[model samples]
Target: MSDQLLQLLFTGLTLGSIYSLIALALVTTFKVTGILNLAQGEFVAIGALLAISLYATGIPMFAAFILAIILVAIMGGCLERAAIHPARRASGLTLIIITLGLSISLRGLALLIWGTDTYSLPAFSQGGPLIIGGAVLNPQSFWILGLAVITLSVLYAFLGLTYAGKAVKAAVINRTAARLVGINPNTISFWAFVGSGALGAAAGIFIAPVTMSTYDMGFMLAIKGFVAAVIGGLNNIGGAVLGGLLLGVLESYSAGLISSGLKDGLAIIILLVVLMVKPHGILGLLGERKI
Candidate 1:
């Protein structure tokens, strides 16, 4: 591969890891509750902002990250109870609209609190870029990739081996059957929302050093995450991982080889093709188990 190509690959994979985290959170929320949460991205923005604020207040980075995640998770749980549970009987479209409303509300709230400022954090580690074949690789990229692998592995184990995880899967596949088997879908859904919040927040904080974090960042991030989930198969956990990586690579390559302005459009284009060609996602049609 050319030096430029190698560099793009590294950059793409790092970005893909962040997208994977967001995609996972979106998938988790959809599987547990049939809601397409447009507000999920807001959790990311909020979490990043909170962590940065906390860190600015002289708190350790580790403590700031943990506190932001926990607070966002709690907020997710509260929102599910306040807004989602009450509309359980609503149609899927209605539930989606509710999330959209929530998204707008959250964005407005964030604007009120944080204004239009953009914030970023220091890299988790202090080091210069690694050189290989005349391509540069940031040290923080390893942290991103390592976290992605660990998160995916932990989630895979949890869903496949643990009773609670099984219950979550059962709830995703068939809530009615899960209930008959003594599983509480409602409770599971609540916890899933909380988990999604933590996942989204972690993604936000991890990428903050690499990208600017603004109140409005959630809008585009949410769209990209949803597109990734759709392309990978919203019902398939593994597919989300694949989709995120694929999207990231495509974005990086397009930006490097073509025009940076057209890079974001790839998500919409790929999403359309995927929906038209294979609505079940890359793995969904293969009868992949929904994690």
Candidate 2:
């Protein structure tokens, strides 16, 4: 019984890390651009699929991963310049709707390119599961967790210790003031999408070994990530990561102890409860400053 619980915990953390990455990507974009990107998940699918294709061409694993992530980031910037930039004067609601449309279009493009097939990436390390007190842990799980930690750490440092990062925060906090201070809102917005795209793609590459990659997988992932973001407080970045891990653990326990069939529904239930109890999220308090 103890082993079973431990096993569930391990699984939950692994999956949660992926959710954290996705949620972090979403929240970061929203913070910098004030635009919630519903199409973020498509970057994940495209990254994994593109990585697979590149790796198949005999490129080394590291090179393939870099190439795919960079390509997606570039595409994100291009989309922002071509589609989103022109709509700069549109209302907030209109911008969100445009993102929704972008999501649909990306998914359709993915389907056309990858078809209905599913693909997988090789685990970062080849090894059998490790047994800890009779509970088994997969090697890929560590890679996922490590990736989450590294990504979070790097992002935190960049946002906290750099001039560009401060400029971004300033732009989001007050566009008029930021502009007066010589910052460019459009450039900030463009970079936000690019960073968001890179984060999404990196998540897909790491999780592909376990979840498998499919053309239609991004939409559901985006939904889950959004739920995580809301649970953590849309305005709080750290809250998003904690929220993803918390949600993942709860989902794991529900599946293991109650019924696997109820797993997907569990997220929505938690989201509702969170919204009702503390709408600002676990870390976000009323009148509190955002990070």
Per-residue lDDT tens digits for candidate 1, residues 191-216, read 88888888889888888888999998
Q: Which residue pairs come into collision in candidate 1?
A: none
Q: Where does candidate 2 have its weakest 10-residue lDDT segment?
A: 282-291
Give the TM-scores of the predictions, in the order they appear: 0.95, 0.94
lDDT of 2 by residue, 1-291 (tens): 999999999899888888888898888788767789999999988988999999989999989999999999998999899878999889889999999999999999999999999898888888888999999899998888998898888887877789988887776566688889899889998988888889999988988889879998887778778888988887777778877888888889999999999988888888888889988887766455566
Task: Note the Cα lDDT for every prediction shown.
Answer: 0.88, 0.87
Leading candidate by TM-score: 1
Model 2 has an lDDT value of 0.87
C-alpha-based local distance difference test score of model 1:
0.88
